[model samples]
Target: MFAPTINSLVRYYHTFKFSHLDAAIVFFSFFQNMNF
Candidate 1:
């Protein structure tokens, strides 16, 4: 059940063509902003 959720997220990300680096940058910035 949990695995399918993760797989769907991965597929969605690929559908949008986000590179690993791009995703990392976005995640990092999101966390940084949330800390404020």
Candidate 2:
């Protein structure tokens, strides 16, 4: 169940044409702005 959820997210990301680096950058920026 958890694996499927992760796979679906990965598929959706690819379908939207986000590169691995793009995703990583967005993720890093998001966390960088977090207070905790």
Candidate 3:
């Protein structure tokens, strides 16, 4: 049913949350390099 979909979404959310900071840093640096 929808349980598997919900579980996968939850896991993906947690992984994204943990990597959020790192992702932001990398994203900003990438843009900065492009701008310069």
Candidate 4:
């Protein structure tokens, strides 16, 4: 039980981080496109 909870927390954290990174990448791409 303890191990499963820990794994879930780690998965949640990783997904959250990935989403933020993805958003930043999208925003950066938009700015670059606008400048061009």
Candidate 5:
């Protein structure tokens, strides 16, 4: 009965995880550029 809700939650979690990683990478690179 709760399968659909669980599936959507997992999907959202993965998407958020990836986007967060991408944002981190971008911020890191920008910071490095500023340091130079």
Candidate 6:
């Protein structure tokens, strides 16, 4: 019952973490481009 919800939440957390890292990398590259 509750197990499915917990599993989904855990998966979502991992996805969010990866997305956050991706955003950071993109932002860093954009900043470098602006500086150049």
lDDT of 3 by residue, 1-36 (tens): 557755764576577774777656755665577678
lDDT of 1 by residue, 1-36 (tens): 657755765676789888888878766765577689
TM-score of each: 0.55, 0.50, 0.48, 0.49, 0.49, 0.48
Model 6: per-residue Cα lDDT over 1-36, one tens digit each: 557755764576577764777666755765577689
Report how far residue 7 has shifted in candidate 5, in Å.
Answer: 34
The CA lDDT at 26 in model 6 is: 56
Could you tally the backbone clashes for each prediction? 0, 0, 0, 0, 0, 0
Candidate 4 lDDT over residue span 1-36, tens digit each = 657755764576577765777766755765577689
- RMSD (Cα, Å) for all candidates, in order, is 4.8, 4.5, 10.1, 13.1, 12.8, 12.6
Better of 5 and 6 by TM-score: 5
Candidate 2 lDDT score at position 8 = 66
Per-residue error for 11 in candidate 4, Å, reads: 24
TM-score (C-alpha) between model 3 and the true structure: 0.48
> Candidate 2 residues 1-36, lDDT tens each?
657755765776778889888878755765566646
Q: Which lDDT value does model 6 have at 21? A: 70
CA-lDDT, candidates in order: 0.72, 0.69, 0.63, 0.64, 0.63, 0.63
Q: Per-residue error at 16 for model 2, in Å?
A: 2.7
Candidates 4 and 5, the one with greater lDDT = 4
| Best candidate, TM-score | 1
The deviation in Å at residue 32 for candidate 1 is 0.2
Which regions of candidate 1 deviate over 4 angstroms?
A: 1-15
lDDT score, candidate 5, position 30: 54
Q: Which ten residues in a row have the lowest lDDT in candidate 6?
A: 1-10
Q: What residue runs in model 4 are displaced by over 4 Å at the alpha carbon?
A: 1-18
How many steric clashes does model 4 contain?
0
